[model samples]
Target: MGKSIFISLPVTDLKVSVAFYEALGFRNNPRFTDETAACMVWSEAISFMLLTHDKWRSFTTRPIPPSTSSEVMLALSCDSREAVDAMSQAAAAHGGTVDINPVEDHGFMYTRDLADPDGHDLAAMWMDVSPMPARS
Candidate 1:
């Protein structure tokens, strides 16, 4: 079987977080969702578990980062440059902050950054490795 990745994030508002992720094309997996957390499916191999702050605390003793701080940035691969732009636009329109960093285009790859309502970072990227220039 192929490996799967599950990223768990602490969120202040479960419903709003779920909506923001849905806007970015993730679907809710109710089988693993309840009052404290929602399992958002990005693909067959990638899933996000959004947990309420209280729920998150149970998993660790570490303090949650303040809203102005970032513990990690999640990168998601897109099918094309247009898909990256579309998802970025959707994220902004759905209460997330867009362009936390400037867009980057490297001939063979393009990327844009965004921050969810609670300030978790996300990067939408597209790459065509076949056309990439040879390294020195």
Candidate 2:
């Protein structure tokens, strides 16, 4: 079987988190979803398991860090710079907070960052792989 990656995150509210992700165009995989968790599939190989705090705690001894005080960030890639902007805008419309840093235009890459309702830092980025001058 092909290898797969599932990023499991502890969410304070399952329904709210699910709705936020859905607004970002992700689909829920019912096969792995339940009252305590929701499987959000970003792609065939990349999935996110939004587990309730209690269910998440069961898998670890460390305390679940409050989202507002956490430092972890999750970055997701898009197909183009426009897409990065679009997703970030969608996040803001869905109650997510956009970081103060202005959108970055690196010529070959573009990026914007946002924080979800749970205060999880999420970044939307795009890389232009077309031929370009090498950086000094």
Off by over 4 Å in 2: 132-136
For candidate 1, lDDT tens digit of each residue in 1-136?
5999989999999999999999999999999999999999999999999999999999999998987787788999999999999999999998899999999999798999999999999999999999767999
Local distance difference test, candidate 1: 0.94
Find the 10 residues in a row with the least total lDDT in model 1.
64-73
Best by TM-score: 1
For model 2, how does the per-residue alpha-carbon lDDT over 27-63 read when each residue is reduced to its tens digit? 9999999999999999878888999999998899898
Off by over 4 Å in 1: 133-136
Pairs that collide, model 1:
none
TM-score computed on alpha carbons, candidate 2: 0.89
